[model samples]
Target: MELTDLLAALVAADSVNPSLVPGGAGETEVAGVIDGWAREAGLESERLEETPGRPSVLVRARGTGGGRTLLLCGHIDTVNVEGMTDPHTPRIEGERLYGRGAYDMKGGVAAALIAARDASRLGLAGDVVVAAVADEEHASLGVQEALRNVSADAAVVTEPTELELAVAHKGFVWSEIEVTGRSAHGSRPHLGIDAILKMGAVLKELEQLDRSLADRTHPLLGRASVHASQIEGGVELSSYPAQCTLGLERRTLPGEAGPEIEAEIESLLERCRQADSEFQASHRTLLVREPFEIGQEQELVGLVAEAAAEVLPEPPKITGASYWADSAFIAAAGIPTVLFGPGGEGAHAVEEWVSLADTEAVARTLVALAARICA
Candidate 1:
């Protein structure tokens, strides 16, 4: 099957992450569709369900052995499509293919499959593994499960990088802070403690922290950052709110200690306690993904660079992605991984698309890279 057609089928599969959007289709159907494609292409494929109802598909074209193993990874699930009209219907406009997951990215998945298929036909000395994982839009459970079951000496994450060699990207930790207070009627000011009002201090502290983070910069990723993502509090207009919860994420640079970040939050909370003895608050970390970086001299990175140099008209851009990806997880697990893929814009936005010409270029480059690296 053609790469474009395969990507269209994938985009049409409704693999919206259920965790991110209620009643979302999840990756079951899309995994099955990929499984069918892999089988028809003469590869060994299997469905892995690390979390029930969320499935990932692994398609392998085994080699003759005694050579390095390479994993081509892409996320199968996409964010919610609420306002976009016909998000699933893939359409080509100029050089781009428009669809929800096209850029952010089922295009990468399709490119990986095509590359793997071509490599399989050539009978390389090392294996080519193509993985389409679930839950990347929320938690990385699918890739986590895949790491436990499958691994490679090196990996290439096809994550919409505009065909750049992303050797580094930021990571983030999810945290939630809860401020507690006593609820009472609006008329009884002395009897009621307003948690919503108390959260003001927390927000101010977070703003300061964000500014502080900006001062710490990385050459590839630029600066560390923090932001409040969601907040909830209050019950009724007539009563003082008893509790307020603030959910936030801090983007960490490579080598930033997790404990130190926690300490920073704790110190901010301590400041609140010092301001008011009765101030009650608690902080907890929900999840953490370490930032990833690799030297451009690494063999896998150099191989892809060489391949991209040959395939692309302009020299391949080696840079850092602004967003986090499964590359962090895979690289953290001791497998050298880098992000490389076709680029478009509007990830998680109302409109999304991928460059068809660039997608084909990536597929061709991957085929050559796999042949060389897996030699």
Candidate 2:
């Protein structure tokens, strides 16, 4: 099948991540579509579903042996299409393919599949594995499961990078702060403690910390940052609330230790306590994902750059992505990984689309890369 057609079929599948949107269709149907294509291409394929109803397809073009294995990974699930019109119906105008997931990822998955199939004809000496995984729009359980079943010498996370070679991207940490106070009637000022007011102090501290982070900037990824995501408190407007909780996300840079960030938060909380002896609050770190970076001297980086040079008008730009990606997980697993994929606009937005020309170019670049690294 043509690359455009395969991508259109992928877009046509309702693979919205259920974790992100209640009752949203999961990756099973999309995985089935990819499995069919892999089998038709004469490649070895397997479906993995460590978690029920969420499936990931692993496809391999086996090589002659004795060379490094290369893994090409892309997610099959997409964010919700709440406002999109006919999001599952793919349309093409000029050089662009329009649909949900067409830009965010299904385009990259299509490119990886076609590249693996084309590269198999080269009779390479090493394996080429294509992992079409699930839940990247939310928890990223699919890539985690794929890592458990397969190991590779190197990996390429085909995320939307506008055809750039992304060697670094920020990671994130989620945390919450809960302030405690005694509840009382609105008329009794002496009997009640205001937890909401205490939380305001904490918010101010968080704002100061966020501003301080701007001073410590990464060359490609820019500044490490933090922002409030959600907050809740108070049962009624007339009563003094007993508790107030604030949820926040911290975008981290390379070498910024999670423990250090936790300590910094503790210090800020301590300052709030010093200001008010009655200030009582607790801090907890809910989740942490380390930032990903690779040195320019890495062999995989050079090989990919060379392959891209062969396929494009100019050498591909080496840069970093502001958002987090599965490349961090792959890199954390001890396999050197980089982000490379087709370019487009409106990822996770009302209208999404991918450049057909760039999608085809990405596939050709991947095939060229496989020949250099796998052979």
Best by TM-score: 2
Best candidate, lDDT: 2
For residues 109-227, could you state the per-residue lDDT of candidate 1 as single tens digits?
Answer: 99999999999887789999988899998988889888988879889999999989999998888899999999999999999999999999999999999998898999988999999
Model 2 ranges with Cα > 4 A deviation: none
* Candidate 1 residue-wise lDDT at 61: 83
TM-score of 2: 0.99
Local distance difference test, candidate 1: 0.91
**Residue runs of model 1 more than 4 Å from their true location after superposition:** none
Q: Cα RMSDs of all predictions?
A: 1.7, 0.8
Clashes of 1: 0
Per-residue error for 214 in candidate 2, Å, reads: 0.8
Q: Could you give candidate 2's per-residue lDDT for residues 250-296 as a string of tens digits?
A: 99999987898899889999999999999999999998888999998
